[model samples]
Structure formats: C-alpha cells, structure tokens
Target: MTAGAGGRPGAAGRFASAVFGIAVLVFVLAPLLWLALRAFAGSWTYPHLLPSQWSLRWWSQVWDTPGLTSSIRLSLIITPIVTVLAMIVCLPAAYAIARYRFPGRQLVLMTIFATNAFPRFGLFITMASLFYSLNLMDRMAGVVIVQLIGTIVFMTWIPAAAFAAIPPSLEEAARDAGAGALRTFFTVTLPLAAPSILVAVILSFLAAFDEAQGTFLVGSPDIVTMPVQMYSLIGNYPDQVAAVFSIMLSIPSVLLLSLVRRRVLGGTIAQGFTIR
Candidate 1:
C-alpha cells in the first residue's frame, strides 16, 4: 500500500496538526512577548509595531521599588512554608486515601475536588469578614492559611494518585524484612513516591507564591505578596514598571521548575509498581 493509504495520518493531517500547534504556540507566547517588550521599551506610541527606543529604567525601578523587596521577601517565606505544611498535612491523608478502603472515602475525595472547583473569589469574599473577626486579616499566617485551602486539595490528589500507583507488595516485602510500617514508608514508599511529592511541593509553592486575589483580599497592606505587589503597582504606577515586576515575579517559579525538571521527568509516578 502507498504511504497515503497506510494507517498513518496523511500529509494533510500532519500539516493541519503542525499549523494547529504553531497557532497554539503563538497564542500562548504573544502576550508574554508583548510583556517583555513593554518591560524594556522606552517609547512606542500608536501605530508603531515596535518600540522607538529601549531602556533599562523599568528594570532599575523594579529593584528600587520599596514594596517590591518586601513583597518578594514575603513570597519567599510564605511559599516554602505553605509547601512544607501542605505536604505534611496531606501526605498521611493521601496515603490513607490511597491504601485504605474507609467509609466516606469517595465523599472525602469529592469534597476536595469540589473545594478546588469552587470560585476562589467567592470563597475569598465569603471568608473575608470571618478572617477579620478571627483577626487573621492582614496577617501572613492568614494568607498562608487561605492559600493552603486550594493547595491542600491539589497536593492531596496528586500524592494519592502517586501512592496508589505504588504496589502494596513492596510494602509487604519491606515488612517481611522486619521493617515496621513507618520505617517501610520512609525507606521504600517515600523514596519511590518522592518525585511526585516533589511535583506536589513545587505546585504548592507556585500556588502560594502567585496567590493574588486571596492575598489582596485578606493580607494586603500588611502582608503583600509578589502578585499583590504587581497588582498594586500596575494600578498606581507605570505599566512598564509593572511589566518588569511581572518578570521578576515569574523568575523564581521558572527557576524552581527548571531545577526540578530533571527529577520530575526522569522518574515516573508508577516507578514503584515494578518489582525491581
């Protein structure tokens, strides 16, 4: 049979797929390109396809901005704390959901998924008054707590899936070798699930670091995160400075993902499914 008549997609199909992929790439990258341009552009009036001049003034402004430094520091402190706390709270719960056939298991899972599915703004609005009453408003702890609601839901589901992918037989083997449940988990199950756990940690950090609405609603003025600072700057300052701040805000997450890309991509969630 000819190549066109073979089971493979025809040239037209390949062409269509390529065109679609290129279109998607452009759609996603266009805004980022514009932001980058605006961040450095000195002047670009209407009808100009590109900037008439370019300068480092906005980049300098980003460093000079007083709130920017504080916001970055707060994000740095909060993101890691949120990631660790979410992992600590979610790990056992995830393991239980993965390993045990408990009452209300489906209900628990559904509740988590539902919480994640809900509109964050609505939740923030509803909780704002409650937070103030509790004296949690404008506190870093409150922002962390608010961010945790979504992160925990996400962190639980991912690790649960990862743990489920691990075979019980491995735990059995570790036990047969005289390892207790906790020891076996730390020794075998945890090592095997580390990659996925790392993914959860990374995602949790990003969620907390980039959290804007909740931070703005509950922690603004007292505890400004990078995203909240970006929003505030965009509202009050020039767009170019805001773009520079946007770039600054994105750098950490990009660096983090780049750092962990090797481990995440090298190890599979189902790595523990195999005997050896």
Candidate 2:
C-alpha cells in the first residue's frame, strides 16, 4: 500500500524484462557470432568463442574452390527468373481472389494453407519422377517451375491483402471514366497496391534466393545454387566455408534493407494507395 513499496516492484519488473531480452538476443546470435569469429580465426581447428590466431587465409581459399564461381552465377540467374515468374503468376491470382467473390474461395484458401503442411521431400520426390519422365530435370525452366509451385500461395497472400485494402471507389471512378478493365487494372489497380507489391517482390525474391530442395531435385548438374555449393564444400573444405559465403549471403540483405527498414517499422503501408 505504501508508494515506495509499489515503486520497488515496478523497478524489479523492468530489471527482469531487460535481463530476459538480453538473454534471448544472446541465445539467437551466439552461433552466428561464433561462426563469423571462427571464419576470421587463423589455425582454429576447434570451435571456441576466442581463437588463438587470426588471418584472412580462409577467405582467399574459398574463392579458389573450383565450382564456387559457377554456383554463385547460377544462384544469381535462377533467383531473378523465379522471382519474376512468381510475381507474374501470384499478382493476378491475388487480385482476382481479393476483388471477386467466387465459389470454392474457401477451398482455394484451405489448399494454400494445406500446402505448408507437406514436407519438402514428399513434393520433390514426386517432382523428380515427373520431371525425369518429361526430360526437364536439372534445367533452368524446371527450376523456375519448381520454385513457382511452392511460392504461388505464399506470395499471393501479401498482395491480396494489399489489393483488398484499396478503396473500390478509386477503381470504380476509373471504370466510370470509360477505361477498359485491362487498362484500369494496369493503371489503377497495380499502382494502388504498389506498397504491398514491393513487400511481395522482396519476400518472393528472398524465397527464390534461398531455395534449395527444388533446385536440388530438378536443377541439372549444370545448375547449382550457392546453398548446394556450400553443402558440397562443407565436407571437403569446412574452414573455407565462413570466409567467403556467409558474409556474401548476409551483405545484400543488410545493404538493401538498411534504406527501407525505417519505413517497415514506421507503418508506411499507406504507400500502397499512392499512385506516384
């Protein structure tokens, strides 16, 4: 009942919260920091927080690996193609679901959610047999198709949410002005949902960049991704792994998102409605 006693409990609660937050952060970051530290360490045959020596030797060796360059190139090429294909397929599909009332809508939604329950191995094994029969294995087109199947429902969600948020009056105004459906969709609908479109594009891009299972199943011997290449290198040259690829993988995400992270946090969802 005393004011001083009440303040004591509040202070203790704040202190507990701070300690809990720090513990969680340390738990999540410990492995990553350890890996980065080990990558820079010289003569570290054992894993430890602090290394006995430090050198850039591992970094240089990672570059000299035979298939590393080809693997990187393949990833760069495949990610964009898959991303473009995903957007093309998901956008119109999302718009239709969001704008129109149709039968089987619940089934469509249920089907999308159900897909995430399936294991990657189950899907890939079936795809492998079908693709092999069609002679499409290990090809770029096959990689795109595989990536698209997994991404269709996921990429559709954000854009549908984005499109649904737009006021119908805006599109109706375009129609009243004698604009055709196709013209209004491109000029009015797409621009109105640009913010969500950006989010969809980024998510799909990251998904394509990180995809491995489908790529492994259908990607020809000729089409290797960075993750697959990383797996290949892990056994043969474990030391070289950290020096080159970890930093490479993380750099783009940091650099690209750094500029827009504030907007993400600032609730800039309103941009979806601004045409310009």
**TM-score of model 1 (CA atoms):** 0.89
**Prediction RMSDs, each to the true structure:** 4.3, 5.1
lDDT of 1 by residue, 1-276 (tens): 233456788888788778988999999999999998999899988899899999889888888878888888888889888888898898899899889998999888887778767899999998889998999998978998998886886588777878887999999999999999999999999998877887778877888888899989999778988898877787699889888888888897888889678755765424422222
- Global Cα lDDT for candidate 2: 0.74
Q: What C-alpha lDDT values do all the predictions have? A: 0.83, 0.74
TM-score of each: 0.89, 0.84
Model 1 has how many clashing residue pairs?
0
* TM-score of decoy 2: 0.84
Tens-digit per-residue lDDT, 1-276, candidate 2: 232444555776777777888999999998778777767777665555477788787777767766887788887888888888888877887888788989987677667656665787798888889998988897888887877777765577767767787898899999999999999998998998887677667756776777777787688577788866666666677654644577676665666567557655655434332222
For every model shown, the clashing-pair count is 0, 3
Using lDDT as the measure, which candidate wins?
1
| Worst 10 contiguous positions by lDDT, candidate 2 | 267-276
